[model samples]
Target: MNSNSLNNKALHVNLREADMQFFRYNCGGWKAAATLSECYQPDRCGPRRFSFVGGGGKTSAIFKMAEELSDLAVLSRPGAEKRKVLIAPTTKMYLPRDGCVLLSPRLCEVREALAVEPYVVIGQRAALPASAFEPKIEGLPSSFLEEAAMHADVVLAEADGARHMPAKAPAEHEPVLFPGTTDVAAVMGLDCLYRPVREVCHRPELVCRLLGVSPEHLLTPEEAARLLMSEKGQRKDVGTGQEFYVLLNKADGPEQLCLAGEVAKNLESMGCRHIAASSLSPAEG
Candidate 1:
């Protein structure tokens, strides 16, 4: 099975259940979870790789997903072999504090961690530059990621860096996805709505270029949809048959939620297949 074949691929929640399941992460098989999310749509556990791009709460989504899959698998197959969930990155990121963190690049160590724990965070810790704040975990090599993916039940990779911003526009070499990534979620914050794009977005210059607007342009629902759909935005490096989702984040209040719904409507009109909106805790993206 390929890496893009798991249950919690990425966010695509059903809007009707927004007040309830939206924040609970109660989702499964993308289509059924359509009432919750359009992430991975597998009825049973399968080898699935999820690469999260854009920003918003991607980091939070990944670990929550790891835990969800672990519990779901354990309950679904009592007394069966435990599931393997790997949280790795294709770019620099912080290692998740919850899992059995294996910062080593060696597969033997990864195998060992997997034996002891169902969820593992694999990466190489790198010191930041002098001006930067702290050390961050660098991604594993592509070859290593591919090899590790083969041994894991679910693989979640953070492919783009957003500096914790709500939205972003990838540069020429941004969003580094690993091989066989089945689903990619372009996470953005609904809070960016009505805010100056330059203030709320990462790589605002690129966003300006994509939207043909000035840096001070405020983001609107329709413009947000355009950015989410633009090849220069979330669709960068995405291949056919691989699912792409626009996950609107930070819809914490009714006002924001309403704006998110508007964005969803705009995206639907543009023919975007997978879309979700929710308020997430502060998680890495």
Candidate 2:
């Protein structure tokens, strides 16, 4: 049976209940795990310079991660000092709503602001007009990101652009990951399943080339799984010794959750060490 049909076989269930199931199945093997955070190693040091690529909810995931890291008294490893987070994009990104947005012509001034603000979004001024939801911000140069890593405790960089699509195949020059990035998160939307590639994926032409399928083809679990594991696709420019993770975002319903399970299983088989199937929306405190 095809993967699309397999995911459809299961009945929908509550999202909270689905969370635990994927945590168990996707989190390698953790004997005692009640909460989502418990599944991974408490001592596991999070990446100092992290980059988020892929197609699904990259912006939301970036902000949500910054909030989660900021809330933690300790940043990952024990005795680690809790410091502010820096959210800058290697590619263009909308200004964050909750955090302070600072655009300084001089990188020195930007670094100074980061020292006082727990959350600061720093980037070049974009050509677009700033709005309530979509504010203007251009991307920073790779040189700036390499140097900026020294100023913040944790840095989150949106390395790819998807034009708000849930999935994407990277272009020849996409996902400009900086050399200092110690970890990478590849996000894909679970909602992309059974949808036409052209509708849900960015760079549909490239996705078609990589998948060897037509743009009109329905995105299946196996196809999505292949793209996730493919070096030219999600794993592009993944530096040596960098911690890599696949985030199956938007698993809000049982069906999408089930699809995430299938995708995670494939990622695991392809040697993905960490996989998370969850909503990227930041939870209310």
Which candidate ranks first by lDDT, i.e. highest?
1
For residues 1-285, what per-residue lDDT tens digits would candidate 1 score against the true structure? Answer: 123122232332222223433531222211223222324453344688889898667876676566656654524555766667888888887644344666654787777666657577777766562234444687878898999888887788889888878888998888899678988888888878888988989999999988999888889999998888888888898889687777777767777767877788778787787777665566533
Per-residue lDDT over 101-212 for candidate 2, one digit per residue giving the tens place of the 0 to 100 score: 6664356655666666555676766677455556557677767766776778678888888877888989999788855888888888887889999999999998999999
Give candidate 1's error at residue 199 in angstroms.
Answer: 0.4
Off by over 4 Å in 1: 1-39, 42-45, 73-81, 127-133
Per-model clash counts, in order, read 16, 0
**How does residue 142 of candidate 1 score in lDDT?**
86
